[model samples]
Target: MHDVVIVGAGPAGLTAAMYCARGGKKTLVLGNTYSSQQSMGGLYENYPGFPDGIQGIELSERMLAQAQKFGAENQTEQVEKIVPLSNFFRLKTENWQYEARTVILAMGAGHRPLGVPGEKELTARGVSYCVHCDGALFRNKAVVVAGYGNGAARAVLYLANIAGKVHLLCTREKLVAESVYLERIKNLSNYTATFGAEITEIQGDDFVTAVGYKVGNTPRTVKADGVFVEMGMKPNADLAIALGLEMTPGGYVKVNRLNQETSMPGVYAAGDLTGGRLQVATAVGSGASAGISALQYLG
Candidate 1:
């Protein structure tokens, strides 16, 4: 039996593995780190210690290497279920089952898709969910931000600096971003916001060339090189739910902010799974907290 078994291999899981292994615990990390949403991000300028910024995939690799160097074992397997036993937890995967004294759930959130035609076909080509990842690729080209709320407004602001022009199509009556973001968006000369607009389709041959939408009863098409869908994200909490862990109304695992401990004993959750700002820095911090708490629990 291992001392700690962390499900998920994103930044939070990797960081927890590094700490747990360094603390002399037998740590095992399940799932592929490269498959995380963090890895989908192209370049990260917000993460600290990287003056020149780092690619999301490169950062994930470094985290995995660091954890492995500290004696944490890793397996790329999808966990089917998690069973809480008398004093330990049993994690069942397709190939194997693991018993651990402590468990950390770091399964990240999945992006809510636009569900528009051509979006799937032109994903990497020009359609992206993360503006920070693909906005730079559309430099000097017009792009469309589809959705409302703070995420959509922030995406528009971020893309406005990189893309030649930014068009925001909001299904809501008005943009629902923070006042600061809304104010900044208004100052951008190349940014245009269309309220009460619904995206009908994403059109492109090999890449996204235009976005089809409707404003009220009028249909419209905007020329663009890229489309950013920022509707939001949904936490991946199937295992947590199955294990009977307490969760927020938004479907994220509920954990103590101090120690990242879940409602169930010996179970913890961190990162996007615990809700809050879904950023690499926050994930790393929370993972560290969970690792330390698990180590303390083992003692």
Candidate 2:
């Protein structure tokens, strides 16, 4: 049995592993970078310590390498279920099972995909979910934003300055957003918005070349270099829910802010799963606290 088992491999989970392993605990991290929200991103200028900025994948690699250097074992497996027992927790995967004295939940949120043809195949090629991470790639080029609401409006405004032209496609008759966002979108010079615009397909061989959509029963296509799906994020909370843990009103795992402890005795949560400012820096901080708390609990 391991002393601590972290159920993620993102920045938060990797940081926790570093702490727990360095504290002389037998640590095992169960997750990988495949579904990481931050990986596959371009440049992150906001994270500190790297004034010149860093690639998301590189940053994740560095975090994982550091944790492994401290004797943390990483197994890339999908955890099927987590069972809390008398004094330990059992983690079941498709091929293996492990028990741990303490657990840290850091399963982060995921981007909502457009669910259209070529959407999945063209990810990182020309289709992206985060404008901030991939907008610079489309500089001076044309792109389409397939979404509505405040997130989509803000994306239109942000892309207006980067891309040569930005088009907003909404499936409704009118854009649904707060007045402030609507006002901001109206001021963009190189932006066009069409309501009742439904994206039928995202087409490209290697990179996105155009967007297929329909507006008011009229089929149309727009030549573009990138497609940004501004749909909101969905938190990975299935395990938390199944474990009967207390959750916040937003459906995120509730945790003690000071120690990152969950409602259960030896269970803790951190990162986007706890739902605060979902950023790498904040996640690292939360992970540090959770690791320390877990170590103290084992003492």
Candidate 3:
């Protein structure tokens, strides 16, 4: 049995493992950290101490290395289920099962895809889910923001500041976002919004060159250097759900703001699973909190 078992290897999970292992707790971190959105983000400019910025994958690798240096064991297997026992918890992965006195759920969320033609083929070529991650790459180039909601609006706004032109397409009758964002979008000359639109395909050969959509019966195409899909995210909280943990209305695991402790004792959640900002920096902070809390629980 291990002292602590973290269910993710992303920024939050790695940070938690680092702290737990350094504290002399036998910690094991499961899951592929590179598959996380943070790693797919490409580059990060907001993470502290890196004035020149750093690649997301590199950052995740560094965190993992630090955790391992501190004696945190790791596995790349995906956890299928988590079972709560009388005292400890049992985690079942594809090939093995682990028992731990304490558990930390750091499984991050996955981005919702457009599922349109050519989108999958040109993912890194020109289509991206994160504006902050790939926006800089398309500086002064035209781009299309697919979907509607606060996330879509944020993508439009962020892209507008970088791209030469920003097109916001939505299937709804109206765009849904905060009043502040809506007001800001109106003042941007390079930003355009079209509601009641359905994306049919993403066109490109080597890189994204255009997006095809239909507004009512009228089919239209817009030239774009990049396509940013902001359809929201699906949090990997199935294990948390099976454990009967309290979650927010948005389906994120609910945790104590002060300590990242979940509704259940000795069970903590951090990073995207706990929701909020959903940034690498925030994930690290939350992971640190969860680690310290788990240590205290053990003591």
**How high is the CA lDDT of each candidate model?**
0.91, 0.89, 0.91
Model 2: per-residue Cα lDDT over 1-299, one tens digit each: 99999999888898999999999999999998645766755457679999998988899999999999999999999788999999999999999999999999999887778898999999999998888778989999999998877667767877898999998888678888778778878788899877888889999999999999988688999999999997766679999999999999988999999999999999999899999988899999999999999999999
Q: Residue by residue across 2-66, what tens digits does model 3's lDDT show?
A: 99999998999999999999999999999898788778765566799999989889998999999
RMSD of 3: 5.0
Error of 1 at 141 (Å): 8.3
Model 1, span 1-299: residue lDDT tens? 99999999999999999999999999999999978988876667679999998988999999999999999999999999998889999999999999999999999998889888898999999999888767789999999898888778878888888999998888799888779777888789998878899889999999889999998879999999999998888899999999999989888999999999999999999999999988899999999999999999999
What TM-score fits each model? 0.79, 0.74, 0.75
RMSD to the hidden true structure, all candidates? 3.8, 5.3, 5.0
The parts of candidate 2 lying over 4 Å away from their true place are 113-142, 147-166, 169-226
Superior by lDDT: candidate 2 or candidate 3: 3
